[model samples]
Target: MRATVNQGPVDIDCRPTLPNITVMLYKDGQQIIPDFDKILPIQKKGFLLNDVSFEDSGIYYCQANNYTRTIILTVQDDSTYLSEPEIQIPSNTHFVLGSPFSLLCMLNISKNMSQSNTKLEWVLPPSAEV
Candidate 1:
């Protein structure tokens, strides 16, 4: 997931509604407390990150019961790119156990920027399967 600086009141939802389920959100491995201004709890279902900034860019984990879903949010500065790149990701990052999943990263660089100089990379978690 990618967002421009100051781009939202973005909502990050946790899925597969279960009865009496409680969702907890974590940022960069640290549990996030709802500060209302920055992180807002969404009825124990997920979180809403308000007024996103560059510092908000990080890996978010939505944990419920023993299941966990991971989201990598990249907050880009609009001034750095001629146009913001389009990113597509699954709404639900959680996968069934032993199931295969794929991730895609694509960029639409501006003509003004040198294509040879532009680079796209994926920084995967150490435990991630290739």
Candidate 2:
């Protein structure tokens, strides 16, 4: 997984949920305590990393019972990009209750960044449906 500095509150999910399971998260072999402001537990099934920075990049371990999974997170500096990407929403957009609407996002990738390295993502409100 790749994230940019200050770009999250990112969630790392533990799959194959089981009954009454407890998940433990670790960074570089050190267990992450929920009380920490940067990384926290999420419903005993995953973790959330907030205010991500380059130091947060490393091997992550998610353990449950006897199963363990490894995740590699790479955090990049904002300077990796020449400039912030631009987003343009249609003018005068409106929607009625219970109606469906679509949004278009346009991004301009810097010449130094490859297509695979540049991604456009939409984060919806918590109440919004996929």
Candidate 3:
């Protein structure tokens, strides 16, 4: 049966047969699950759409014919689209001694800087003035 929730589009579903039925959900097999979040009890052989969460991701079991059946539920992460920022230089990348070298330093930015053409200056160490 379609497990619609919050009147929103259904992401997952659950189906249990008769002979072992109840409004509340039960963990099948000998494995005892302490908490069953997001899943509402099945009262009168019907489940509504107001149940589910991202953390409720796992295998669920239902008892039938003195045996247990399994159903896997999963939620995808929205943060997967975010990419890592490009590094200007390796953390261990060091300069050689006695050689005048310039490294284009990157400014610490919280947002994307790719859209702007702004130039960044390398923050150099303090020079010794005598």
Candidate 4:
């Protein structure tokens, strides 16, 4: 499922909705329940995110007792109304020790995305090894 950042929340629930079964949630590959800030109680069964972000977009796993279900979440940027920005780095690279090289960040934006609200910013690492 796809959701827009700062627009609407996303919800997921177990199909069977067992009474005594304990529901657990996982984002990407890590457990995020209890510690997640956006989690909210669902209709007596499952949970929902109050506000989603690009980082929240990933494979969501729900473990209820022995039953497990997965949901793929694709969060869109509110500004551009597009999916998360993708940074592509070529495999082969040529860089001089002290020379400056330009890095390009790429993202797949469709016609539905807003061009005027899109802004790109580059962040540098705190320290460089070389």
TM-score of each: 0.55, 0.54, 0.34, 0.53
| lDDT against the true structure, each candidate | 0.75, 0.74, 0.42, 0.70
C-alpha positional error of residue 33 in candidate 2 after TM-score superposition, expressed in Å: 1.0
- For candidate 1, write residues 62-124 as lDDT tens digits: 888889888888886554574455667779688777888676656877656788888676677
lDDT of 2 by residue, 1-130 (tens): 5433546777777654775887888889998877767776667447888888778888888888899888888877654554555666689988788888776656666566688876666678999776
lDDT for each residue of candidate 3 in 8-95, tens digit (9 for 90 to 100): 2223223456535432334322443324243344443433323344544455555545544455645443322233334476567777
Q: Runs in model 1 with CA error above 4 Å?
A: 1-6, 84-130
Candidate 3 TM-score versus the reference = 0.34
Residue 24's lDDT in candidate 1 = 80
Q: What does candidate 4's lDDT look like per residue over 10-119, in tens digits?
A: 77765455566677788888987654567875646577787677777788888777788888888766555556667666679887888877766776666766666667
Superposition TM-score, candidate 4 onto the true structure: 0.53
Q: By descending lDDT, how would the candidates be arranged?
A: 1, 2, 4, 3
Q: List the residue pairs that clash in candidate 2.
A: none
TM-score order, best first, reads: 1, 2, 4, 3
RMSD of 1: 14.9
